[model samples]
Target chain A: MLDQQKVFYGILGLAVLATLGWGMSTAGPAGLAFAGAASFTIGGALMCLWERSIVRSAFSLMATFCGVGVLFILLGADFVGMAQILIYVGGILALLLFGVMLSPPDMTERKLVRVGGGLLTMGLGVAWVAGKVAATVKWAALPIDQLPEPKSHAEEIGVAFIHPEQYVVPFELAAVLLTVALVAAVYIARRKMSDFVPEVASQQENA
Target chain B: MLSNITTTAATTAAAAAPSENVVFHLLAEYVPEGVPGWILPIVTASISVGIVIALISVMAMGFTWLERKVSGHIQCRYGPMYAGGWHGWAQPIADGVKLLMKEDLIPIGADKALFMMAPAIVLGAIFGAFVAMPLAPDFYFADVNLGIFFILGMSSLTTIGVVMAGWSSNSKWSLYGAMREAAQVVAYEIPLGISLLVPLIVAGTFNLREASELQGDFYGMGWFVFKNPFMLPASILFFIAALAETKRAPFDLPEAESELVAGFLTEYSGIRWSFFFMEEYAAMYLMCLVASVFFFGGFESPFTYMAREQFGPNAFITNVVAASTLIVKSIAGIVLMMWVRWTLPRVRIDQVMTIGYKYLTPLALICVLGAACWEAIF
Candidate 1:
């Protein structure tokens, strides 16, 4: 009754569910439990729904992100919740949409390589071990209620960007990375647009 | 001072305590108090949203009419007339109705879902910026502590939405326009964020109310705009960058009628196009509002404090003067944007890029340094 692949995925799902439940219990009664249950259910369902459609997969990923956002909200981290929505839903989802547009028309016919059964088993086992270790760690023993109210998390982050601790370097690094990406995108777009220029130029000159 | 402390504590206790507590307390003060605690928060939030929406909509409509009149006069034509018994005051309403009644069409090959989502997204992002904007003393939605960052973060959503609309339409012109918009907005955001930093650095807090309050007394132009000489230029630079980012007038490459055949909006018609128009107008007002609040002293009348000193703490007079002055200042900024839009010709796309990256960026960096030095020296 137990196929090896099915058993591996089932164990993985159960581990994620258990960890999520523990987090939800500690997260208080502010819809975090709902978010956790929703995410687990959706993520589990995505495995069954994985098909030839890229849009479907993208939607599933988006659902997972929405759950993460709710969890952030439950933690009373409204700024983080908004950021999660802005970045993942707005930016990453748009990027995925672009990916869908760029993918070959006959996506269903294209043969995609699958991992070996042994590798899958090994990965699942490693994940299981990691989860076990994480579960045993007494994270809840740390104080949480004493945390100061986050009247303005964004303000704190902004100040941290100026102050030389925790975030200044990383903030600069994000800027640099963004600049690099901008340059690369411009270069690629320019190169692509220029490919048909010779014919258009000759026609213009003739006219 | 003694009474002030008691009132503050009472209000705090009122907010935190159960509705029953407040109701009983108020009942003790006057009539039978039996209201619930949660009712207070719900009532406050609802009233806040209602007031904010009402004030913002009225102001936004006025700005729209003013822009049209200004543009029409500049072009040697008559503008709105005979609405609300004056110069065509109700023209925007008529236009809205016309747009609403127009046919909504969807192209066969277009990505229907995103095409619909794009304008909605743009409106949502721009409207969201209003939450942190303060009108008068004790008037704001939410009073977000991280107001500056929240504004920036919310505004950035427009870029994604514009890109989606352009790409989803499956039209060549729209795609090109969207690409240009993305490039332009992203480029300008750097300088915009940098210019904002000059004020943030001076104010030492991202809270808009705190920043405004720190600008010294009312009536004095003791805002960040006047604090350091460099801040004036920095504020101007920020406004220019905002105009470009919002794709207003000379920087409106996304819908440049002369070049790209209406650009990204070529396919959109009727109410959909009006949605884009509302987003643009709203963003223009928001930009001016941010400028006024950050650089100029927000909601501080030029003569309010003088009047207060002379007349002795008349709350009614103080509020009226502050509201009027704030409205006038914000309108002046909006009018200035309109003038620039009508007066200047659209810059070429390449020139636009060059100006934004080459000139604006270096100038913004110089202003940043100048501002820091000004702070140090004086």
Candidate 2:
């Protein structure tokens, strides 16, 4: 099973690399972006299917995040791309792995079971979305040639967040929201002093 | 008169343009025209990767030797003196050869795929961070606009590698080490990033090369560490946070030798173990380079006249001087780290968190705020 999985991933990785190389030679940045997107989506799906281990699944998620970051970089959103990696891989994934590791062993080891009817429904839903996207979008009419030269958006985004005429309010609101969430999370995770006191008293009475 | 003006403008523009001496441009000249568009970038990338790998390997070997000697002197003993005659100059090489010949081991019931992939991921994260590092004015792989941010982001990926290694090892010790590493990295990263922002705020740029160039005046006095009163504290904060980030003592709880028996490394053997070791030293050097770039005059010498005025006309000389200066400064930073490691006792895991969250984080935040105000006022 391990060897089979290796072959599957090996082929997938090679295909992605080949696509990336071809795209770079022929269609340039747009091709690379497309290839990155395809690799992330397809590779992530395959990893989810092949890996029974939850921890390995989390690693696949990190790869998907990295692919998204690559797409952002290709689109000239360098700051966003880095932020994607920092926030998703560094912050979220670490928390996720910690949670997984700390959880009950049995819960962590449960294999992903597939339901036949659910798979059919998921496939149909995906097909419908693809059809809708195809119908609504004019892919051939994209102005690939007219695309502007790639440039960094770091300064622009930074200034925009603080500029009164730009996204200042939204920026402050986001900060406030994050602070609130952080406080709430700490509140939930913290061990209450009152509960600890009661447990200590019970232990003392037993002694 | 118009021609004179045009000629002067042209000269200025030429000077402002990126130097033709950069590795990328040099590689570009070697490619035959009309061959293929992708071939140039591919070739350039391959060469850049080759150069970085070779440099990193040599540095790793040198650092391992230095570390042993440092550790030996601190303990009042000679370390590896016989490996290559005087001072064990060839000790790392011998160790590498031995490691290569050693039998590779996989523990029973270990996840083979992840076990194999972990080291590669760790090394890849470390190498990717090098992409944005400007070794000299004309000696970088890529000068991304968000260069510092890119490095920070890539460095964070190492946590995933650590987690993978620990879990895949199928050992209690490995799991403990991995968890500790994950927690420590996540904790330290906040202060590390916030402290880094002080320099970014002062420079008003995220590009490391630009930041370094910004400090290329005042004969090194203009470096960010001395730019403001707050900057000195900020640099110290960054260094301490960096120590934690690299898992150097007193923050080396993850692999605490007295406690976890090499921690996550308990299961690793041979070349696989060496990969982790190399990555550690490489990361230490990378953080040192980052420190020099952010706080000290990166490639710029204290004697600005020598770096900028005298040798400015010769691109090659200027690049070489700049590269040497940066390396020297980085080595100094590495030595400082070693000094701290040998001097201080290891902190417990809880104390590490307390230092990171309660002390370092708030101090860094205050420094950022102060630096911003300082910039605005003066």
Candidate 3:
């Protein structure tokens, strides 16, 4: 098993490097970085196929998120990239790891169970829709003539949210919705007052 | 037609000047003329990576020695007097050699893949953060407009590594340490980010170099630390939060030595362990450098007039001086951290949470508001 795992990782590493080389040749340095990050994401996702441990899967997911973050940076969406790292890696992944560590020990021993037929069909349907959308969008395939210069779109994004003629209402609505969700989450997570009262009454009766 | 002529003239002038930035000029000199455009950027990136690695290694060695010597002095004793020629200045080198030759041990039942990758992730995150840092006006790898934001984002990546190391170790203590690290980093990040926003609001930019440039006057008094009453408290909050973020003492519950036995690091050894240490010290320096840029006048000299005047003909000297100033300020920040580490007792995990959520967060929020108001009024 150990030797197999090593071989698996070796193949993954080689595949990633090969992709990176291709990216460099096609898109130059920016492309190279993007390719490297993309390879990590892909490799990590592939690892999930063989790894049964929930903790290992969580790590792989984190790697995928990090790769996505790098891809954002390469695309000049600096604000988005930073947000990806902050929210996904720092907040969500940590929370996931906490859940993994705190759960029952038997959880890690479970194998990756195959999905039921219905769920698999639903997944395929969703992918079909995604493919349709993907086909409709035109992706520019520029030649690798020059290195893509890094641009800062942070100010533009900040402005668009509050520009009045742009996405101000949608932005404000998103904030309100997030706030509501947060309150709802907290209310759900908190221990019930009734439960505490019952415990208090039981203690008094026993005394 | 008129615009075309002016554009051409501008291009000619730019070609004549050949960019005074050291990295730009150095790469230009090395890459032969008529090379592909992509080659320059690739070569420059490679050089930057090389420089970053060297910088991290050298600084980590120095910090390890400095940390030991400081602890020793604080405890009233001589530290490693015989490891090297004088006062064991080469103690870190000796330690490095020892660590290299020591047995590389992986605990039984450990998750080998994650265990092996954890240190690399931590080190990579720190290195990524360093790319956006500005040592001097012309000395950064990339001057992204959202440089400070990028650094903050990259620094948060370290938590993932810490968690991976802890979880993969399959040890209870390691798990506890990882959990503590996750909680601490997540909690402290709020205040750290809020404090950072105070300067961001005042400067109206997230670029570290630009922020530093704005305070490049009035000698040291022009620093954001002394910018306004709000900034003073903001700086204090930032410093405290930074201490927690870096997992330094008084907030070092993640690796509380007496309780957790090195925490997430319990299962690591040899070069793997050294990578963690290197990441920590490098991160410490990165945080200090960032704080200096935001709160202090980054690469700006205390002699404001001299700094401004030296830009004419002695530009290279100015760059060197600016870089040195930033380094000195960063070192001072590191020393302050060391002082606090040795001086204070480690806080309980609960206390750490209390400080982060109860005090620092609210105070930092208030400072942000106050800073915004101050900026508007001023």
Q: Which candidate achieves the best lDDT against the true structure?
A: 3
lDDT of each: 0.66, 0.78, 0.78
Question: Per-residue error at B138 for model 1, in Å?
Answer: 0.2
lDDT by residue (B1-378, candidate 2, tens digit) is 111111111111112222232565787777776786545554555566567778888998899999988888888988789887888899999999999999999998787878988888887777767766888776677666677877788788888888889888988888999999999998999999999988888888887778888887776557888887788898999999999888889888878889999888889999999999898899999999999999997887765437667777237777787888899999999989998999999999999989999999999999999998889999
Candidate number with greatest TM-score: 2
Please rank every candidate by lDDT, starting with the best: 3, 2, 1
Evaluated at residue B335, the lDDT of candidate 3 is: 95
TM-score of chain B of 2: 0.92
Each model's total of backbone clashes: 4, 0, 0
lDDT of 3 by residue, A83-132 (tens): 88778887888888887876544334333244355447768987999999
TM-score of each: 0.73, 0.90, 0.88
| Model 1 spans with C-alpha error above 4 angstroms | A1-29, A32-134, A137-148, A153-207, B1-47, B50-55, B82-85, B307-317
Cα-based lDDT at residue B208, candidate 3: 87
The DockQ score of candidate 1 comes to 0.15
Clashing residue pairs in candidate 2 (N, C-alpha, C atoms within 3 angstroms):
none
